[model samples]
Target: MLRSIASTTALALILSGHALAEETTHDDHESVTLYRVFVGDHADPKITAFDLDKPDNRWTFETKGQSKLYGVGEGAAVVAVQSDGDQVNFIDSGISLQSHGDHSDIDIEEPEALGETLTGPRPFHLIDHAGKVVINFDRGGYAEIVDAHDLSEGEVETVRMPQARAHHGYVAPIGTGWVTSVASDAPVEGDKAPERVGLQPVAADGTPTGEVETCTAIHGEAFSGAYLATGCKEGILTVKAGSNGPEFAMLEYPSDLPAGETTGTLIGSKSMQVFLGNYGAKGLVVVDPVDEPHFRYVELPFRRIDFALDPANARFGYVLTEDGTLHKLDVLKTEVTDSAKVTEPYSMDGDWNDPRPRLAMAGDEIAMSDPKAGLVRRIAKETLEETGTIEVGGMPYNIAVVGGSGMVHEGEGHDHSGHDHSAHAHSHGDPQIYKGYFEDSQIKDRPLADYAGDWQSVYPYLQDGTLDPVWEHKAEAGEMTAEEYKDYYTTGYRTDVERITIEGDTVTFYRDGKPLTAQYSYDGYEILTYEKGNRGVRFIFEKGEGDAEAPQFLQFADHGIFPAKASHYHLYWGDDRAKLLEELTNWPTYYPSSLKPDEIVSEMLAH
Candidate 1:
């Protein structure tokens, strides 16, 4: 199978100090990828940052009030907006990745608070664009613009709105000035803010530059490609850079849609030029600004709890419904591709601020905060399967992810030629083959020694009723019936190849007794942790001079990651390495060619 590679996330562009050093080429370099999750508590005035690479390594910072976290400055820092406390705090994520033409450099450090806080009257909506951060003070009737680069360097400089009246509105940076929501000057009763009427482009000094564009009851906003879209009661308001300043346009809702439906929350795709917005309660609208009939709606079975777009895989979006099922939406196809039950039912009848689940993407995994359980569940973005959960003390409400992949180059003057560094060894001369039960680490490029053997696919055995005993044994030990177990493995083990033989760097795939030989070179390994807290490493290899019909990439996953002969393994091959990594289903499993059907069943039951 093949999949497309999309653009990198903003985190991949934020480089650390070490990455800015003078460039030098190295003979060897190591690939490093890291992700840090920042979570805000519902009841406590604190935020926590967990290093996904090292689960035990985490840092927490106290805030002035309960906060919502946002990753800003292209992932170099996170802003904690405490609307109830009327203050905002900043934290340096300390994880940075920089792209340098051919490769990227990564730097990791302890996350810490920036010791800078912005205080105002009811700071509500925040926007990050073009290296600038804008915080709108709904009650203050003004907005403050801060340079993200300056914020990262311990400098706090703000450009404030001039003579602006109070309103529960928003402001975003565009061109050399800003596009802000315009509130009606009519007097209001009680402590309520002014009524939002339209939007206007303002100069850098907060002076209006253009006439107001009527966008009634303006609410949510997001940027995708060259367009910035905002939700409006009438329809959607879009903004783009213009020669004069900023150009604004209104895209009214199609007549065929429901009469009162509108989107209040919006998310944009990083890899594609599109936007996904929550339409009413049980529907989502996918918008393409450049195309006619810009909106397409997807109805959910239940009210949506929260939804997120996959930045890495751009075409996929995830929605969590009140029924506790996570549906994977193929944005390109405008349909649900897969669904899985991930959490207990979270009713939508309580207060809007009641603890509920929120979604954030951590690399290839989706981090969802289960407030009632006080845990953050990590689910695979591709399979929608629960991989692991991190326990947080109080209810974790809001979360933001920061980090990317890069290269760690060796210092000059060092030569490790002809040395085998693929595997690590202990001081007692034993190879550190088994990582800790809960520990996961990046594995280096390994040689073919780990898989140099003859293997036979188990799919044939399962189809021939040879694995019936194994399924019955599992049913006796588990909750499922024997027939149910058989159906599950039948779906999992469906493959064509019946055998494989590996010698040196060459591999032979036997299909229908016809063999196709190929040569491969070591690439890298990716470690995936399962729901049971155990991890498996997929040793990847790239095809070299080999059969013309052979796949470009091959991944072998066994229980071992170090340099040791494998007894059995699962094989995956595809043209796209990134896409191949996301394949959780249809893994063709194999056993030692010397093992008999009875012996294989015995080994399976033993596990």
Candidate 2:
């Protein structure tokens, strides 16, 4: 789901061995070797190679006829495929070239042709394991699995949901094969459009209706041991890996939370929790599947452009904010540890599907896809330093790098006189980070801190009810009348109304410790409301009008409604109260149309 990409390469190194000999004895800090990043341009259809130690320098590799690549998959090896097109290429990361030491020796194979010619549309995503590739074509609505090493023939899995329209989908290889989202169901016979878009509005308060569709297509997916978190519009469909197939469970958000929500992006953590992005709220939300099936809402500081969890380091992950800063977030502590500006501002205005840079982690390098810059930014995780770069021809959208010296060249290859390192200079950056050799015993316990852009810090505290704000009304629920109380607590409200006091035909509302006054009819019929920035709250009461003095009171939630006397009414007697009037006018637009006013109000108070 990450798209930002830029490529710039540099060469620099720190002298080692003599004075640093003392630090080498320390276990936590060990010098890195054989670090490289594979970045694909966003504008062009090319993949660039960069040495992590020296990111400023890189080499660009043109794909088969310069076809646009949509996604990159990395496991035992790295595979890049052209979406909505036919073709796939694979390279050997096991060998290192000269600049990358003798460890990197890339063996490139000829690009393989897809089975079907111009079938509906090309592939949208590439799922690769070992040397196998599964390309899902959105237009055809079928997945073709091919041998990446040799694509002469392969297997094809057809996802035929006669009632579904495909958008973005993925296939899981290790666990369950493929599970798609349900975007739209088919119409009857020759109907132009489908009867429904598979979305049924729940309580306007943002509660789950639990309505199941005949079919669904999830946009994105990630695997954690045995679970696959599928991002869907209705809710996350939790798929548990089973011997038969993945088990499906739908989780919805609680109704008491704020409205406007959708889980657009999903990433599973090692701790069994799922990180989800709410496109409606424009913030990152964390959901503990074990705690509650429904997701919990936690607001973020800014819009999240791209994010990823580090499987190696669970304590923290990096988030690239819209402002172009790489924010190192402590997921465990739920706080930002550090941030640095890394790119130019790319507004989220224009098209919703516009191309933008994204974040990715490859070994010790934090690879940033800068579409505008047409380059990839490589930074070291430990020092947060820009080690190198790769200048790609077009904008790079997504990247994945995997390949490192396994045993630190336990053999004596240095006995040679001349080794060609310049050929790799254009692809990798400085040779220093990957140049010097290290003893395996010297780095046995060294931290994998060198892995940048993809590293995460672990959450120290247990994720559960502790992080949620306590609901004070829960403990005192039994004290109220069971019948009348049914309408007392607003299970959910469009706005947070702390309290409302009512007396003989008059009412005065208090919001966050401030008194608000308004007008009504009847002998007293009083009303009061207040506006705080974007928040608007109102209180309706019927009691004898009086001043702030000994006004009759009616209890609601933690708030009290009192009589609104002449003095309070005069403050808002005319057009000066336009803000409150505007808010009330628009209240119904967000209120649940499915529920009655009394039911809606009661649920808000109780929630």
Candidate 3:
């Protein structure tokens, strides 16, 4: 059922540069933030990439068969597992973020397929952890461990496990070796493979190193912080990195709870040290391996359609039920904090492969694919409001998101050793605030004069015909069609504000020609670095005297790191400054009020 690839052929193909891309660099101190959504079609042998920052930009790659996509190498690349075709293909997501002690540098290129194609029989489960990808080939009765970094560079070198009896099992990397499933020596029956009995830790050379831990009917697996967990009918089997080797334990399901309940599929939190698993058809359980009363069960109203955990916001998990409701689960609180109707009713009574909605977290938003509707809806995580939608042709099924904020420093041959240490400091405890060291001399405290002027919103110009030329110019440059560009900007520039006027410490917001003024005082600033190697500085101001309805806090972002006159700017206001910073969508932008529509179009085209 599986076939091995020739390493020499793969190396030759990659060296020919047939599927490699050139890296992209940025000027010094320039920040770059990009997130890409990879969508696999329900039935087609294709995958589409949607760049979240550039709405009009799209890329589709042909595959041997339909695949289930997974982002690996910390968002640097993606692997497409084609079980039916017995193939595994690698994709350079064209986005790489390298971390320094204080900040990270990002390099972006065009997405391309790697020359290597890992062919194996009935490739099933995949686990990406500790800089490696472990792919389970069920029919082949083996697993291949590939270094993620090498795969991203178009190199193919896999450490294959010694072949055993063919069975539906899994293997995961742990403590320099691996923890693999163990099959019983029971007599075979019919055409079905032998069932897995337990798990045993093996040396890096595929030699067994420890006794098998009893875990019957083992199915799903996940990694939470330092521990790797797998589902078992008897209990939750856990493995941790030990000084000698991998240490294993079993946390049994509490007897006081339901009797016949067990978890199958598991999801782990990246920010918090916890795991969320599906307990039966209409229930979820939060498992804490190291704590007492390990399992906390949450009963759902209906059978689950799909569930995903927010990697950035570790405290939250999302579940979409067959009733068309998406419930937001607070993992720390072990309860559903909020619920919203996001899609049409997707009944559980259907084929397991039926087209349904899948959830993926993109930056601060949650992307849910509505396959029947041929759309991917973007929902704001905090408000759970539908912010926008992407019309992905055909049924968008399995989805994976990659990319984050990174810095693009200027000039060639710049030494990364020399980091800017001025205008920044380290802080912790507040999860809302940006953690880690920030080395930017340009980011500092400034007065309100940096934005003291009467400004107009660009949303109106985009609405009228004044901005059509800008779209046409973009279309001419082979981005998107003029109409498509217009549609894209319609979502980007959407705002209710018509104008904004600032004088001294007073800020006035005009909506429908009515002015609401408020007074504010300086409340310091925070520099936020994104996963894509880009960073932003938010000048915070707290309301001192203002109208009853005015927001309590205001943050100004005009692409200016320090004190300077702003040509145009985006403003965020709310009662919570930390919560306001999480608002990536619906930023009401402002330009000089004196500029005419023609002038505005010219300004836009120049950028």
Candidate 4:
């Protein structure tokens, strides 16, 4: 919950203020619809609200709560927690009171406080499911649930499983509710607490017995239908809460693979599924607990910090990279469709525990909460442009988005009484009309056209310490000299290249600038491989006529291993083979250095 505002984070606003500041000149008596972001300042223990329609606008809300609360939950209202572990406050998300408008008066209300009742060993996580807020205490191994509205009095269901030592757990709303237990045992005399907790399953009454199962590092849980999935070092723990309540099963990884760990997880939004991230692998393990327990792997360049399924479009989900880029993935194809740079390099160079930005998708907006900047960047779902930003006080850790259809009423009795209050107007100047100029004229502007299909950049740096290669260069409306061809080819060679010899297709050259050879026609089973030195090369090819254009079976004579052929396929360690094929197919799509060391190796192998 570190919330120091980065005074060094620079904001350059060079666009014409007149264009964006044009007055709407609405009916003075009519209630204006507004969505305001309220942020809690960690350093000052203060809260402020910003008008989403006007970036330069702000309002301050008084808070006697804790100064360093990690996550802010937005429900039918905005919930703010005090840093001192004393109180929680709620702000109406519906119609934010405007300071300059007719609604100048501030609407403030203090509900209930946790008081001394909340001061436990440690309040690790504050989670909200439905309207109930639960605070988990690690020291006491218990959970306290609160009525989100009242905050003072609610049900406190405490389950003391003897082997439960809090690591990371999540409470999901099923038929009732269930908490994932981080397996642990009671303290023994003269025995030091082990680094990892060996699993001892809880019986029907939440009591551990029987043989100790060697399971450690049980992270969070996500619910999909009757199944609740939890990520563990062994694989995944699948639980079903049905007629019999909750039943548990373990889905382990392939034994033949190298020993790595599994930590991160995200349940599939549409199906009876979930995703497990192998800290050791480059790809994501797609888990369908009821169907295929073994899971399938979807490879990508960077290790995903977080991902969100587009509730609007189930085929797509976004993966935010450490380098501050959001990658669009087609879940159906299990392929990356596009990517765009959103923020400056936060980097993966520091300690894994260091503060960084996390991503969350709220309605049509995709937001990244940058703890270092003390800002929440709001990206438009369609164009992915930074449409707006609000300054919050404390470092935001976890965010839960609810109440999308939320609306504001003039008063509690302002409910619909056979009357329509949505005053309609169609001005010639729709906000979207000037959106283009707004983009072209701004420094941080992102164009909508860029989102048509998937966009990818080359791997910025290769394992060999060389730059990525590029594939093609046009001869500006006329034929060029042989020297020009050679120069372009040399440029492609210096960089990594994606061989897209087909017309109208765009390909990238690696950072080093290696040019692709002439457009070659292929027929039958034509296999081409590229390997620079010993490591294998990963290449993406464009479909063309015949088998030559089609993928081929690649085998390395030195290693005696046949690598699979597909434009987007995994190539772990094919020294000479990777280099030659990359030389044969498309140029390099430079991946940023933001990916972790192990992630890069895994991504390359999977490709």
For candidate 1, write residues 127-206 as lDDT tens digits: 98755788999888888888776765556788887536778788886644578898888898998667788889987777
lDDT of each: 0.74, 0.41, 0.74, 0.41
Mind giving the per-residue lDDT tens digits that candidate 3 earns over 368-485?
A: 8899998888998887889989999899998999987666545533333322111111111121212222458646788886776567888888887888888887777644699976
**Runs with alpha carbons beyond 4 Å of true place in candidate 1:** 1-24, 410-607
Error of 2 at 81 (Å): 2.8
lDDT of 2 by residue, 7-125 (tens): 12211211110101111111111122445567766556567765555554455666642333322223223455665335555544333321111222221222222343323355565
- Cα-based RMSD of candidate 3: 21.4
Candidate 2 ranges with C-alpha deviation above 4 Å: 1-32, 54-59, 64-74, 84-86, 95-120, 128-133, 147-168, 173-217, 270-273, 276-281, 293-298, 352-355, 382-394, 412-607
In model 1, which residue pairs have backbone atoms overlapping below 3 Å?
none
Model 4: lDDT equals: 0.41
Candidate 2's error at 316, in angstroms? Answer: 1.5
User: Residue 492 CA error for candidate 3 (Å)?
Assistant: 50
TM-scores for every predicted model: 0.64, 0.50, 0.64, 0.49
